[model samples]
Target: MTWLITGGAGYIGAHVARAMTGAGERVVALDDLSTGVPERLPDEIPLITGSTMDADLVKQVFAEHGVTGVVHLAARKQVAESVAQPTRYYRENVGGLATLLEGACEAGIERFVFSSSAAVYGNPDVDLITEDTPCAPVNPYGETKLAGEWLVRAAGQAHGMATVCLRYFNVAGAAAPLLSDTGVFNIVPMVFDRLTRNEAPRIFGDDYPTPDGTCVRDYIHVADLAEAHLAAARRLTRGGAAGDLTVNIGRGEGVSVRELITVIGEVTGDGRAPVVEERRSGDAPRAVASAARAAEVLGWRARRGVREMVESAWQGWQLHHGK
Candidate 1:
């Protein structure tokens, strides 16, 4: 079956596209190239250079490529920027998704995999976040994702389609240096940037209610996350589940900021101390995934550890920086 992977040239999308194609699944990629790198995609995969907001273009791609399934990963994901411009986030993430869903339903696509986020459970009070955890997004970005999930599920139910929403935790590492995440939105790359400049990495809040007084998070390798998508897509094709499947893609392990900084120092051979600063607002003290539902539903679990993530990420950093 031919699958259309939106934002397939970006870091996570590129990995998903490669994994799907490697599994012998027919694939076509659609990316706007806003922050995506075309070079990251395999040479043989056909790429459509456009946005999902363009209903005409999306429909054209679906019809032209004979797309039977869709993996939607295209969205404005920056939390801070989403807060600053909520309307744009709604328009791009939510509105664009509605348009795409309309096109997908019209084109007779029955399977869908949406890219959700852990941000939907903003600052959860629970020890570990599960698929059943209450969703209370603190930022506009997360709100848009939750709203998109509703739209996807409603559309699927109405159209008799199978859908899966994968809520991602902290994504890191890379399948290859070229596929490494180029954005510095997460701690891994933020610390990598500071180390590259021989500067002390800034640790955002050290007074959190966690070990070593720093925030803790669940970090998952990008490759493992991509494989999770494959599992979800495969399940959709089987048609056994009664409703849309929602699952978390994580390792079910928590790593503190201080601990991660030390790991980075060890991995990069740069043991520069980090500079602690006041806590950023909306920062969760601890956010870890249960990952039980994912295994039960998709038979998928993360295989790579934090050390491997750091090692692979450091290699990508060196390659990208020419260090």
Candidate 2:
């Protein structure tokens, strides 16, 4: 079955496209090219330039490509930006999703896979966050994702479509150098950027309750995350019951900021000590995933470790930045 991957030329989107097509799945990509590099996608996989907010364009792509399933990955993801511009986030993330679902239901599309985030859980005080964990998003970006999930489930129930929401946690690394994330929004890249400038990396908080007084997170490799998407897509394509399946995509392991930075220093051979700063607001002391549901439901697990993530990400940074 041919699947339409929204945001298919972006960093994570490109990885998903490569993994799906490598597994012999027919896939097409739709990207606005705002932050997406069209050259990242294979020439065989058609890259349609448009937005999901455009109902006419969404419908046109669905009909013209004969798309039987959809893997929606297009959305604004910056937490600080979302907080600053809540309306824009709602319009683009939630409103755009509503439009896409309408087109999917109207087209009789039955399979859908949503790209969700662990941010929906906020700063839960649990050791390992499970699928049933309470969602109390501290930022507007997370709020939009939670709302999008609700809309997806509601649309699925009404239209008899199988849907899955994968809440990703701290996505890092790259499947290839070219596919590596160029933006410095994430922690790994943020640290890389500072090091590239011959400056010390800054740790947000060193007074938290966690070991080393830093935030702890579960980092998953981009390639493994892509495989999880393929697994979710295949599960839907196999004709499962018409319902919603939500799971967290993580390694079920926790790595503190200090530990990760030390590994980064080892990888980059620039062991400059990180400067400690005041804890950022809305920072979670720990946000590790249980990862049991993903393994049981999708039969997928993360094979790469923290060192691999840093090494691969550093390689990608050097490739793109000439560092």
Candidate 3:
């Protein structure tokens, strides 16, 4: 089946596009090159350059590509930035998606895979969050993502579409580029970018309720997260499930900030260490996912572990920084 990937030139989208093409599937990458690089896309995969907010452009994409399924990874994903500019987040994240959905429905696309986030759970009280957990997003970014999820649900209900919203938790690493040109504000690669030479990676909320008094997160490899999208597409294609599906795509383990820094030191061969600072408000102490639902539904599990996450990220950082 042919697939249309929004933001296909970005990190996770690029990885998914490559994965699709490597499996001998027909694919079209629709990206505006905002944070995305054209060089990231494979030549064989046709790249459609335009904004998702343009209804005519998105419709044109569907007409030219014969798209059967969509992997929608395009959105304003920065939590801090969203907090600063809520209007931009609403317009870009929610508005652009509305246009995309209208175009998708008109073009008769039935399957969709949304890039949701564990931030929707907004610091769940439970040790491990599940699909049934209430969405109480703390930041504007998370609110927009949750709104996007609801929009997907509405589309599914009105039409006969089957959708899977993969909620990611502290996504990092690279089968490709972990350090994709995420805006300067992101957590992982931004830290690595600053520290490629001797700069220290900054840690917010050093005294969290975790093993080492630093925040703990479930960091999944970008490739594995991309694979989860693929598996969901197949499951939906088989007419297996109905209604809006939300699943956490995490490794189901907590990697502390200090632990990650140690791994980074090993990866970069720079034992410079991370600079700890006072807590950032709205920061979750520990966010681990009960990814059991993903395993059951998508038959997907994160095969690459913590070490791979650190090393592959270093690989991308080294290449980006000419180290």
Report the lDDT tens digits of candidate 1 across residue range 19-60.
999999999999999989999998889999999999999999
Model 1 stretches astray by more than 4 angstroms: none
Candidate 3 lDDT over 1-323, as tens digits, reads 88999999988889888877876778899998888888888779899888889999899889887888899999988888898999999999899989999989988889988888887889887788888988899999999999999999899779888888989987777786643544445565666776755588878877776779998888888888878877887788777654578889999998888888888777777768688888888878888999899999889998889888777876777677655
Off by over 4 Å in 2: none
Per-residue accuracy of model 2 over 129-239 as CA lDDT, tens digit each: 999999999999999999999999999999999999999999999988999999999999999999999999999989889988999999999999999999999888777
List where candidate 3 sits over 4 angstroms from the true fold: 177-184
Against the true structure, what is each candidate's TM-score?
0.99, 0.99, 0.95
Candidate 2: the clashing residue pairs are none
Candidate 1 clashing pairs, residues 3+ apart or interchain: none
lDDT of 3: 0.84
Give the winner by lDDT. 2
Which clashing pairs does model 3 show?
none
